[model samples]
Target: MTSVYPYLPEMIASFGVERKDVAKWAGATSAVFSVAQSLTAVPWGRASDKFGRKPIIMTGLFCTMCFFLAWGVSTSLKMAIIIRALQGACNGNVGIIRTMVAEMVQERELQPKAFSIMPLVWSVGSVFGPAFGGLFAKPAERFPGLFGNSYFFNKYPFALPNIIGGVVFLISLSTAMLFLKETLHSKRHSRDWGLILGRRITEAFKDRPFRRQQKLRRYSIQDAEASAPLLQTDGTSRPAKAGREKPVAPSMSSVFTRQTVISLVSYTFLALHSVAFDQVLPVFLNYPPQEHTPRNTSLPFFFSGGFGLNSGHIGTIFTFYGITSGVIQFVLFPPLCARFGVLRCFRVCVLVFPVIYFLLPFTVLVENATTRYAALLVLMICKAFAVIIGFPCSTILLTNSAASLSILGTLNGFATTFSALGRASGPALAGLAFTWGVKNNMIGAPWWILGFIAAVGSLPVWMIVEGEGPTAGSSDSSDAESTDAEEEAVVFDDDDDLLDNLTTARRGSGREQQGLLKKGSEDTRNTGYGTVR
Candidate 1:
């Protein structure tokens, strides 16, 4: 998707759209893709819960690869829209990825670093994607000596970027196919062809006898675990090893608690405006530069102009931002989150977005190229810094709000639907806002609108109650009048359909490791989320 950004206007115009309406066409394609994602994200999440994370992830990657190939060759706007939609339909993997991270890293303290991995991965793609799009689009014209007489290059002006994107997707898909494991507990222990094949391939690289021995040893371990006897809790003489937990149907009624709703609301609004910002920034940069004679306009409210940069320069700018973002994620965000705490860090991140949007139009006024670049660097660095803090912190809170570890995938999936809806609406609204500003000579109109949205998004942050969760087994609660009869009913593991009847304990509690280790254990008592192994 980032690969398409640099050449999106050119791509749309090649299909007969007028220069004035290219933003509209671009928005249409982007909107269609997001709408498709919105429709499928929840279903895909549910499928990950029911089937397994690895399968859905592989399927998404495969679909994305196909979409890239198809989109590369699209001859008309209609074809572009269709292919983009298909691309969106397969991209419900983000939530599943988050779910896996939450499951894999159980400690609350480690969550900021863990969740930051996805955004960092995206930053890597953003850096390369824009570079590819800018440098490679319309190769026939850019490098006529090499591609001038090639019919393929002439007919498919935008093919190079998509081809590169396809190759990247293929690499990711291959990696997932060979090594990715199923994170869903219930679906785990089932045969994983990827891991098995991965082992076989690795062993094949060794000497023959070494390979055979490794395979034999591997099989012995797996077979012993598979054949392990179930532990008896009845105090019988039979001493047995731990065995697979019986599968239980996950219940969803309790998933959407008050905290969950609050988190989703903030997440949705954040998605809405941030996506709009991304859509409009390049278009704003690509707009015509203002002349020496200034128009009769008020400061901030009435303005008409842009950075007037070409695709290559614009892509380089975005690539710079991507690198800066990765740096901030690695060096800044985690430390700040750790020192100040996730909620405080999140609130500070949320509060600054409106200011960022408000300042964007001012960058257009600078005449000196160096000054303008400096301004952009500052604005984008701030934006990246905030984003790096916001997304991971938000995800951690979202996971905290989940009623059961089992429902993390479902909760993330369910929430992704709304975020996808926000993304769906963002491009179209931004296009309209940009168009309106162009006609009205108030180039800052879209910025103001987005600023308002960011302000609105900040509202729910205050309402959110951030903690590890509703901590279970805390002795500090004031319930002086309560007796044994008034105590919360004990829930046995066998009795809980969600497989998690109680909440996770306070962060840093000793029970955190216990709850994580005992996951999916059949004989595990109905203990609070804090105690397990």
Candidate 2:
């Protein structure tokens, strides 16, 4: 979509369609794609748990490759839309990949670092996707028969770029299929569906050790109160109770509790703001000048030279942001979380995002070539920081929250779905805002809107609790220990039974050394020791 966006006008012209109509069409397509794409996360996650992560991932990749190939060869709008929809339907691996990594890696301490790498890779993809699109979309006469006649060039000048995208997808698909391994643990076959589901739910509730700790604290308080009379200044004495105290009511885990739900809602808003800003930035930046002049081309060195952004550049920027964020997640975030706590780190990131968006609108204000270039550079740096901080932090929070709930897979799917919805809706909303602003001759208004939206979105981050009970890592460790203990007990019982069997066999066989010697002596003498003589 990033690569082919430049040819939208051309496509509209060829199809004899209005810009508004095209925008509506694209927006609708985006929404549809978003909803379909969201569904893949949880099911893929559950499938990973059921079968294996590797196979499910490979399946998704295969589907993506096929979809992209179809998209590249699409001859009409209907074909393109269908292909795009299919692509959305198939590319549902992100959430699954997140879960797989979480499952495979221990030291919940490493989670932030591990998750950061995803955004980094996405950023790299963003940089290349459009550059390749722009490069390949060049006139066919330039390459002649490089890709056979000028049919593609005539019908769709950007066809080569789409082909490149398809090829990339294929390569990615193959690499994933060959290299990726299953991360989830294998479970025993169970014919009892009710038991399985119930157990999973029960485990989720039980996973939160925070509740247990709370119970212990309450019990300790009660014990302290009960013992207070012994230490009273009046020296009152009471007989000790022989009966045990009633058991305390079980404490509910906070993983899927109200607090977690609020945090998720906050994240949803942040996602909405982030996606909207990302979607609209390019449109706002590359707005055509009111009066066409050669001077307009003198925009800025960054905008004119290597860093210059067209729509493709915008996509590249997003890809860069994604890759950078992913990297931070995989490499930097875990350590940061361990040091600062997830909520603290998340709040800091959320607070900074709006500032970055605010600065983006000012890029156009610096008219001097160097100043304007510097402004754009600053914007990119800030944007990179925003991505790095916001993404990994949010993901860490979500994963941590889910881990607490023992519904990591389900929560992950839900998060992905909401994220997708935001991503899908954001672009269309941004497009609508941009189109309205531009048509109404309200220059730079959309940037302000984006910034304001981002600022408002940050409000939700405040709801997140710091140092909420046990970290996900600690919870997992406790669970592992419990499982080990259970296994050890079973082994101990088996050993005990085996020891009993051996003792019985020895007695039954009369295999004691002394017994054997006495029997042998009695047989030789035809009498027992004293009696034999």
Candidate 3:
């Protein structure tokens, strides 16, 4: 995915697209991918909730493999666009993977360590993907000794890199299939692979006419116990008897408290501005320098223009940035987050974004290539670090803000959907801004605009009040469900109503919250309501 950005012009040109329209076409291609993500994210997340994370993840990887293979073979611009969109539509694994990480590692204090791996992986991929795309693309032309006159390479010039990408996904899929554990608590009890397979086969054959030919033995209570026996009160296992049954836990609802809503909105704003900046920065870095004119002679090449670099040079720079990002995320971020606390660190990082945005466009001032590259490496590292630090912090906040495990998938889905919308709009708008600024002899206008937007993105952070982070072994699922309900009720009830309710709750010796909790427990037991979570 990161590879696609640096090679946009080459890919666009292969379809006989004109040079002037390259920016527009590149923006459209990127936009369509996000559009597809926006449409499918929610449904994929919901499916994962119903089934399991591994299933959805594997499905996504399979689709991506197919998409990459198809992309390599595409003959037209429209085919490439369709392939990209298909990849996005089937690639809603981000949220589901986050959900898995959250579930697998529950302690809030340790969450930074766990979540840091995500950005590290991304950084590594971002570093190598561009290098591979830039160096190995159109292999028949680039590496004549190896691929010249080879029928496959001649016919599909970009096949080598794309095939390598597909193979990478294939390896990931195989590793996941072999080693990834199912983390869903609800499904944990029935996780015997044999039983699962048998159940699936039975279901598949139930409606077939051949199924009626054999006398099928009814599943006995002993079989149920053998498959998934109930847990004893003493943390041991025992077969469930007739009358006594454990009460089902409460499901998290879609309705969010004021804090969760504010945090989500803040995240959306930050993502919108950040993505736009990312899209514009790469394009600007590779653009040709503006010619000197009498009226525009005052504008330094550094302030209002770019350091003219080709695709390969730009990819190398990004590779360095990615390396720096990996070190920061792995070695730097966790301690900073632990020391300052997640919310405070998030605030500090977000506030620094505008500064990074403003400073990035000034790298053109250094005339020497080595000095210019060093300056950009430092500036870009700082910028990437800020975002890397804030992103996982924001995710932790979202997960902690969620009501319970039952609705975790839904919350992450919502977050991804909003992010997709932001990403979908960002590239096109930023590209348009860049195109317009360059046309009007105001090359720095886009940077100035992006910096201002980033500043605006920081505003919503103030609305999210911090709370105590979840601690290890403090509350199990049931207690968490009840406590989250109480907190949500106290925090989100209207201000006027809150005062009255608090007074009433005090008069009842704080029994009001208990009553609400009890009522919720009863609803869970009586109705077994399966939806809304």
Q: Count the backbone clashes (under 3 Å) in each candidate.
A: 1, 26, 0
TM-score of each: 0.83, 0.67, 0.77
Q: Ranking by TM-score, best first?
A: 1, 3, 2
Give model 1 RMSD, 1 decimal.
9.3
Top lDDT model: 1
Output the lDDT of residue 30, model 2: 61
Instruction: Name model 2 segments beyond 4 Å from true.
Output: 1-28, 138-148, 187-255, 291-339, 403-406, 466-533
lDDT of 3 by residue, 1-533 (tens): 54345656667767898654565667667777777887888888788776777788889989878987888787899998898788778876578888889887878778999988888898888788777776777788888998898999888877777888888898888777654666655454343454445444555667666545321212211123113444322223343332222223323444266677877887777777677766666677767765454656455532345666666776677777778888899889999988988889989988888887777666665567788778877877778888889889888887777656666676677777778777767777776777776666666666677778778878888777764432322234655356435333222111223234434544554665656434433332343111111
**Worst window of 10 by summed lDDT in candidate 1:** 220-229
User: By summed lDDT, which 10 consecutive residues of candidate 3 come out lowest?
Assistant: 217-226
lDDT of the candidates, in the order given: 0.74, 0.54, 0.67
lDDT per residue for candidate 1 within 1-533, as digits (tens), equals 54247878778878998866877777778888888888998899888877888899999889889988888889999999999899889886679998888777767888888988988888887788888888888999999999999999899998988898888888888898776766665555465666667656865787877655343233321211112222223311132212223334455667778899999999988888888888778788887788534455567577788878888888898889888988888788778888999889889989999999999888877778899889988998898888778888888888887756766777888778888888878778888888888888888888888899899999999988875742232121122113212433221222232233323422335676455434523233222111232
The numbered model that scores best in TM-score is 1
